[model samples]
Target chain A: MQQIINFIIRNKNFLLFLLLFLLALVFTIQSHSYHKSKFVNSANFVSGGVYNSVNNISEYLHLKSQNQLLTEENNRLRNLLFNSNVNADSTFIDTTKFGLAYKFYSASIIKNSYTTKDNILLINKGEKDSIKQDYGVISSKGVIGIIDKTSNRFATVISILNTTNKISAQLKKSNHFGTLTWNGQNPATVQLIDIPVNAKVTVGDTIITSGRSSIFPKNIGIGVVKDFEKDVAENFYEINISLFNDMTNLEHVYIIENVHKQEINNLLDE
Target chain B: MNSSLILNISRFIMLVLAQVIIFNNVNFYGYINPYIYILFIAFFPVRDNRLTLIFVSFLIGLTIDMFLDSGGMHAAASVFIAYMRPLLLRWSFGTLYEHQTIRFTTIDFGPKISYLILLTFAHHLVLFTLEFFSISKTILILQKTLFCGIFTVILSIILSIIFSRKTK
Candidate 1:
C-alpha cells in the first residue's frame, strides 16, 4: 500500500499531463458535428458584433456611391413600371416578388480576402438586420457570395470564387442547371461541372442561378460560360465561367433575407 | 518570485492577445501570417525543470489550437519543441547553459543569434509540415518556412535586445 502511494506521488505531474492531453484529444475526436456547429454559431454571434461596428465607420465614408446606386435602381424600376401592361384584377406582378420581392440592407465590407484555400468575407450585417445563413449577397455589379455565419451585427460569407463554394447554376438558354465550383487558380473565373454530356453547352452561353436554391432567387445573373470540355470520366462536362463582378474591388453590398426560408428548411427536414 | 516573473506573465498575455486579435487576421501576401506568439514559450527562463517546461509548452500549444481550430497540430508541435529545447540549448551554448538565468543580450553574439534563428526555424518547419501533411508541396513548404522564420527571428532579436537585462 505504501509503495503504491509513493509511486502515485512521484508520477503525479506526468499523470496530470496525460489527463489534460486526453481531455483535449477527446474533445477533438468526440466533437459531435451538431455540437461543433453550435460552437461555430456562437462564435459567429460574438465576432459579428465587433465587425459591424468597425464597418459602420467605413459605410459613412462611401455614402455618395451608395446613393448613386439607389438612384440608378429607382430609374430602372420606373422604366419597367411604365412599359408593362396593367392587369387590374390581380395585384401580383409575377416577377421576383414584384415590389422588390426581397428586402435589401446595405452593409460595408470590414474584412475581405480572396486568396486562400477557402475565401471568406466579413461584412457588417447581422441578426439585428434579419440576416441569416444561406441568404444570397450581392453588389451592384452582380452576385457576391452566400452568408455562412451570422452574429448580432455581423456575418461571414462564402464567396462565389471560394474553392469550397458550390452553388447550382444553369445555362440561360436551356434551363439546365450544373454545379458551379471554383478552382482556386483564378478569382475572375469559376468552374461549372456536372453538366450532362447532352447539354447544348456552347462557349459564351449566359449562366445564371437555377433558383433551385432556396437561398437565392431563380435566374439571378452569375456569369457567362467562357470555355467547356468533357472530362475523361465522360459522365460530366467541365465548364469555365467568366464572372461579371470583380470580387477584389467590392465595397458596398446588400444582404437578402428570404421570407420562405424557414418553410423550405422544414420541408427539407421532413 | 521576481520582477522578471511578473514581466514574463504580462508578456505572455500581450503576445497571446496580439496573436489572436491582430496578427492572425493579417495576411500580408495571403498565407504568410507571422506567428510571433511562440516567442513567449521559446524564451521562458532556462532554470525551469525540463518536465515543467514541456508541460508549459504543451499548454501554450493547446491554447493556440483551441482558438485557431487547428485540431491537434499545434499541440503536437509545441510538446516536441519543449522536449528538445534543453538539449539544443546545452549543445549550442555549452557552459553558458549552466547559468540559472539566460542573459541573451550579453551572450556571445554569434552563438546567441544562431541559436535563436535555428530554434525558430525548427519550430516553424514542424508546424507547417503537419499543417499540409505530405512530402508533396515541398517547395511551397520551404517558401513558407524560410520567410516566416526570417521574419520571426528578426522580431525576436529586436525584442530580446531591448528587454534583455544583461545589456545594462
Candidate 2:
C-alpha cells in the first residue's frame, strides 16, 4: 500500500496530463459527430451572445454592401411577384403562405468560421425564431448549411465546408447525384464523391441539392463543377466544385422549413 | 501578490479576446493562423503549480474552441503544450530554468527564441493534426504547421519583446 501510494505520488504529473488529455480527446470526438454534445451546446449557448454583440458592430461596418445585396434580392423577388399569377392562389390570403412546400425565415449569421476542418456558423435565430435542428440554411447566392443545434436565442449551423457535412448533390444538367463533402483544403471549393463513372460530367456544370433528405428542398444552388477524376476503384468519379457563395464573407441568410417534411417522412415509414 | 493575480486574470481575458476577435478573423491566405495565446502558458510564473497551469491552459483552449466552433482541438493542443513547457524549458535553459522566471526580457536570447519556437511548433503540430485527424492530409498538415508555427512564433516574439520591460 505504501509503495503504491509512493508510485502514484511519483507519477502524479504524468497521470494528470494523461487524464486531461483524455478529457480533451472525448470533447473532440463528441463535437466531430453529428449529434450535438452537451459541452459544445452549452459552449455555443454562452459564446453565441458574445458573437452576436461583436457581429452587431461588424454588421454596421459593412452596411453599404449588405444593403446593396438586400436591394438586389428585393428587386428579384419583386420581379417574380409581378410575373407570377396572383389569381392562382386565391385560397392564400397571407403573403406568408407562398406555398405549402417550404417556408423561409430570414436570419443573420452572428459568427462564422471557415478555416476549421469542421466549421460551424452561429446565427442570431434560435428555437424562439422557430428554428429547429436539420433545417436548411442558404444565402442569396447558394446553400449555406444545416442547422445542427439550437438554444433559446441562438443556433449553430454546421457549415457545408465541414468535412463531416455531406449533402446529396446532383448535376443540374444530367441529374447524376453524388455526396458533396469538403476536402479541408479550400473553403471556396468542395468535392462531390461517389458519382458513377457512367454519368457524363463536364467542367462548369451546375450542382444543386438533391432533396433526397428532408433537410433541404430540391434545386438549391451548390456550385459549379471545376474538375473531375475517378476514384481508386475506378467505379466512382470525384468532382471538384467551386462554390458560388463567398463563404468567408456572409451575413444575411434564409432558414428553410419544409412544411411537408413530416408527411413525406411518414409516407416513407409506411 | 494580489496585483500579480489581477494581472494574470486581465492577461487571460485580453489574450483570449485578441485571439477570438482579431486573430481568428485574420485568416491570412486561409492557412496561417497566428496563435499568440500560448504566450500565456509560456509567460506563466515559474514558481506556480503545474496542475494549476494545466487547468488554466485547458480553460484557455476551451474558450478559443468554443468561439471558433472547433470542438476541443485547441484545448487538447494547449494542454499538451502546457504540459511540455517545463520539460522543454529545462532542455533549452538547463538548470537556469529551475530558479528563474521565463519572462522574455529576463531569459537569454538563444534559449528564449529556441523555447518559443519549439513550443509554438509543438502546439501547432498537435492542433492541426487533431484538426485534420487523418494520415491522408499529412502533406497539408505539415504545410499548415510550418506556416502557422512560424507565424505564431514571430508574433509571440514580437509581443514579448514589445511588452516585456527588462527586469531591473
Candidate 3:
C-alpha cells in the first residue's frame, strides 16, 4: 500500500498533464471540426430558451422605436401603392374569385446567430401565428430566410446567408439564373454560381431572386455584383454579390405564407 | 472556512455571470469580450493543487461554452492556459515561485507585471486561436486576437491591481 501511494504521488504531475492534454485534445478535435456531439441539442434548447427570454426583454425596450419605424414604413408603402393619381388597374385588385394568395404576419427575431455554418434565426411568431416550416421570411429590403422549425410561439428560420442555404437567384437585367451561396468568408458578400460564361457580366450588375421556387416572389432584390471570376471548371462564371440588407442587423421581418404553397408542393411531388 | 468557501463560490459565480451576460454580448463593434472570469482562477488560494486549478478553469470555461453553444472552444483555450501556467511561473520567477507561494502585490513589481502580461497573452492566444480554428484566414485571426487581447489584457491587469490592493 505504501509503494502504491508513493507511485501515485510520483506520477501525479505526469498524470495531471496527460489528463489536461487529453481533455484539450478532445475539445480541439470536437470544435475544430463539424462533429459537434448530438447531445448539444439539449444545450441548444436550454440556452435557446434563456436567449429567448433575454431577447424578449430587449425587444420590449425597443417596442416604441419598432412601432415608429413600422409606421414610417407603412406610410411609405401606402404612398407607393395608393398614390392618389394611380390608375385603378395598377392598384391591388379585389378579385372575388381569387383566394387569399399570400398572408404576411409580422414577427420579431428573438434569437439570432450568424457565425455558424447552419445559422438559424428564431422568431416570435409560430404555429399560433400560422408560421409553419417552409414559410418564407423577408425584411423590408429583401429575402431573409425560410422557416425550418416551429413551436407554439417560436419558429426558426434558416437564413439565406447560411452556409447550408442555397436559393435560386438571377441577374436582374438578363434573367440568367444561378444559385446563391454563402462562401463563409464575409457576411456582406454571397457567391452566385452556375451563371453561364456566355452571359454578359459587369461589376455593378444587380442580382435578384429568380422566383424559380414557389417560396419567394419573383425579382426580389438580393445584391449587386461586387466582383466576378471564372470558376475552376471554367465553363461558368462565379459572381461575387454584396447583399443589400445586412442580415446581422435584422430585427422585425415579415413571414410570408403562400396560399398556393401546398398546391405547388403537391405538383412537385409528382 | 465555510464562510470563506461560500464567499469564493459566490464571487466566482458573480464574475462568470457578469462576464457572460454583459461582456460577451457587447461586441464593441465586434472587437471586445472582456473575460473577467479568469480573475476567479487567478485569485484562487495558493494551497490548491495545480491539477485542481486546471480542473476549475476547465469547468468554468465549459460552463461558458454551454451558454454560447460554442461546443468546447472556451474549454480548450482555458485548459491550454492552465497547462502552460506552471511553466510560465517557473520561467518568470526562477526557483522562488516553486519554493514559496505567490502573493501578487507583495511580489516584486517586475515579476508580478511580467507574470500578468505573459499569462494574459497566453490566455488570449489560446482563446482567439480556438475561437478561430481555421488557418485559412490567419490574418483576420491575428487582427482579432491582437485588438481584443490588448484591451482585455489592460482591463485584467487593472482589475488584478485593484483586487490585490483591496486584499492588502
Candidate 4:
C-alpha cells in the first residue's frame, strides 16, 4: 500500500495528463455524434454575447451590400406577385391558405465558419425566441443549415459546409434525388452523392431541397451542378455543385419551423 | 510572482479573444488561419509544477473550444502539447534547459524558432487529426498542419519579439 501511494505520488503529473486527455477525447466523441447534447458549445451567454456585439459592428459595415440584396429579393417577390393571375370569385377555393406547413422567423448570423471540416454558425435567435434544435435556417437566396443546439438566447447551426451535414436534395428537372455533402475542399462547392446515372443530369442544373425530411420545405434552392463523374464502380454519379449563396458573406437569415414535424415524427415511429 | 500571474491570466484572455474573433475569421485562401492561442502554452513560465501548466493549458483550450464550438479538439491538442513541452524544451535548448536558467526573452533565435515551429506543428497536427477523424483525410490533415504551422510560427516569433522588447 505504501509503495502504491508513493508510485501514484511520483507519477501524479502523468496521471493528471492522462485523465484530462481522456476527458477531452470523451467530449470530442460526444460532439461528433448527432442527438447528443454537447456540454461545450458556442451557444452560451458569454461567447454568444461577445459574438453579438461584434456582429453588430460588422452588420453596420455590411449595410450597403445587405440593402442591395434585400432590394433584389424584393424585386423578385414583386415580379412573382404581379405575374400570377388572381381570379376573385366567392366559389373559388384557396388551397394555399389551407396548407401552411412551415413558419419563418428572421434572425441574423453572429458568427459563421466555412473553412473547417465541421463548420458551425452562431445565430442571434435561440430558445427564448422559440427557436429549437432541428429547425431549418435559410437565407433569402437559399438553404443555409439546420439548428443543432439552442441555449436560452442563442443557437448554433450545423452549416451545410460541414462534413457531417447531409441534406436531401434533388435535381430541379427531375424527381430523382440524392444526398448533399461537403468535400471539405472548397467553401464554394459541395458534392451530391447517391444520384443514379439514370437521372438526367447536366452542368448548370439546379439542385433544391427534396422536402422529404421534416427540416426544410420543398424546392428551396441549394446550388447548381458544376461538374459530375461516375464513381469507380459506376453505380452512382458524384456531382459537384456550386452554391448560390456566397456563404462567407452571409448576414441575415430566416429560421424555419415545421409545424407538423412532431406529428410526422410520431407517425414514423409507429 | 503576483504580477506574472496577472500577466498570464490577461494573456490567456487576450489570446483566446484574438483567436476566435480576429484570427479564426481571417480565412486566408480559405484554409490557413494560424492557431496563435498555442502561444499561451508555448510561452508559459517553466516551473517544477508541470501539473499547473497542464491544467492551465486545458482551461485555455476548453475556453477556445467553447467559443468555436469545436468540441474538445483544441483542449486535447493543448494538453498533449503541454505534456510534451518539457521534452521539446530539452530537445531544443539542450544544456540551457538542463541548467534551468534559460529565459525565453534571452534565448538565442535558432532554438527559440525551432521550438515554436515544432510545438505549433505538433499542436496543429493533433487538432486536425481529431477534427477529421478519418484515415482518408491524411492528406488534408498534413496540408492543414504544414500551412497553419508556418503561419503560426511566423506570428508567434513576431509577437514574442515585440513583447520581449517591451519587457526589456
The lDDT values for all models are 0.70, 0.86, 0.73, 0.92
Clash number for candidate 4: 0
TM-score versus the correct structure, for each prediction: 0.72, 0.92, 0.74, 0.96
Candidate 1 is graded, for docking, as acceptable
Clashes of 1: 1
Give the per-residue Cα lDDT of candidate 4 at A146. Answer: 93
Docking class of 2: medium
Model 4, A22-102: lDDT tens digits are: 999998887777657789999999999999998888789889988999899999998988887865545788787887889
Candidate 3 yields a Cα-based lDDT of 0.73
Name the candidate, 1 or 3, with the larger DockQ value.
Answer: 3
Off by over 4 Å in 1: A1-103, A160-163, A183-189, A200-206, A224-227, A242-251, B16-30, B48-84, B87-91, B98-101, B129-139, B158-168
Model 3: native contacts recovered, as a fraction: 0.27
Candidate 4: clashing pairs of residues: none
Candidate scoring better on TM-score of 1 and 4:
4
Q: Which ranges in model 2 have alpha carbons more than 4 Å from their true place?
A: A36-38, A41-45, A87-99, A267-270, B100-105, B166-168
- List the candidates ranked by lDDT, beginning with the highest: 4, 2, 3, 1
lDDT tens digits by residue: candidate 3, A86-198: 57767677588578777888987876666544456667776878788777898877789888756677676777756667789999889789998886657778899999999
Model 2: per-residue lDDT, tens digit, B1-168? 788799789999999989888887878987578999999998888787888899899999988877777778889999999999888999989878776645545778788889999899999999989888889889989999999988899999889887785433
Tell how far residue A48 is off in model 2, in angstroms.
1.3
